[model samples]
Target: MSAELDLSPEVPEPTLLESLLYNGFFLGAIVQLLCILAVIKPTSNWYEQV
Candidate 1:
């Protein structure tokens, strides 16, 4: 029974570097999305003005 339990694989936890990279990527995506919206907003306003 102990041998069978030992045979089970343990789940790996995320390291500090991995967590930082993951959060960085998430924030980068949000900033990029906001930038895209900003660019589109000006264009939309310009179109309305015409």
Candidate 2:
């Protein structure tokens, strides 16, 4: 029973290119969100300006 339980399939680690692509995607998403916020923020203060 213990041996059976220990027979779970091993997960493969990510390769270097895969790691870089994942990190790049995450950073790109963050930067896109910040750019969107920057664009919306000025418009959001339109009432104050008026």
Candidate 3:
């Protein structure tokens, strides 16, 4: 029946802070990787001056 079809499982949405923290953690990880790469590759002009 149509009603039975409509009863498919639904996933809950993340809370605002939970979403922000999840995304923010990846952003921070990317930033840390760039910092480490800059330190390891100082010959590149992009990282050398700063």
Candidate 4:
């Protein structure tokens, strides 16, 4: 009888470039939400001309 085990595997760690790309997408989403809110409401409306 013969048995063998494979202890090593070919896998790559995340590089800096890959990490930055991931964060960019996340940050963009938050910024977009803020922009939408700004368009829908105003902080003050004291200049209503009748």
lDDT of 3 by residue, 15-43 (tens): 99999999999999999999999898875
Q: Residue pairs in steric clash, candidate 3?
A: none
On the 0 to 100 scale, the lDDT of residue 50 in model 2 is: 75
- Report clash pairs, candidate 2: none
Error of 3 at 46 (Å): 10
Full-model lDDT for every candidate: 0.87, 0.88, 0.88, 0.85
Clashing pairs in 1: none
User: Model 3, stretches more than 4 Å misplaced?
Assistant: 1-9, 44-50
C-alpha lDDT (0 to 100) for residue 42 of candidate 3: 77
RMSD of candidate 2 to the truth, in angstroms, is 4.5
Give me the candidate number with maximum TM-score. 2
Superposed Cα deviation of residue 3, candidate 3 (Å): 8.9
If scored against the real structure, what TM-score would every candidate get? 0.64, 0.66, 0.64, 0.59
Off by over 4 Å in 2: 1-5, 43-50
TM-score of 1: 0.64
Q: Poorest 10 consecutive residues of model 1 by lDDT?
A: 1-10
Instruction: Estimate candidate 1's alpha-carbon lDDT, on a 0 to 1 scale.
Output: 0.87
Q: Residue 2 in candidate 2 has what lDDT?
A: 55
Clashes of 3: 0
Per-residue lDDT of candidate 1, residues 1-50 (tens digit): 45544667788999999999999999999999999998877654567687
Better of 2 and 4 by TM-score: 2
Residue 39 of model 1 has an lDDT of: 85
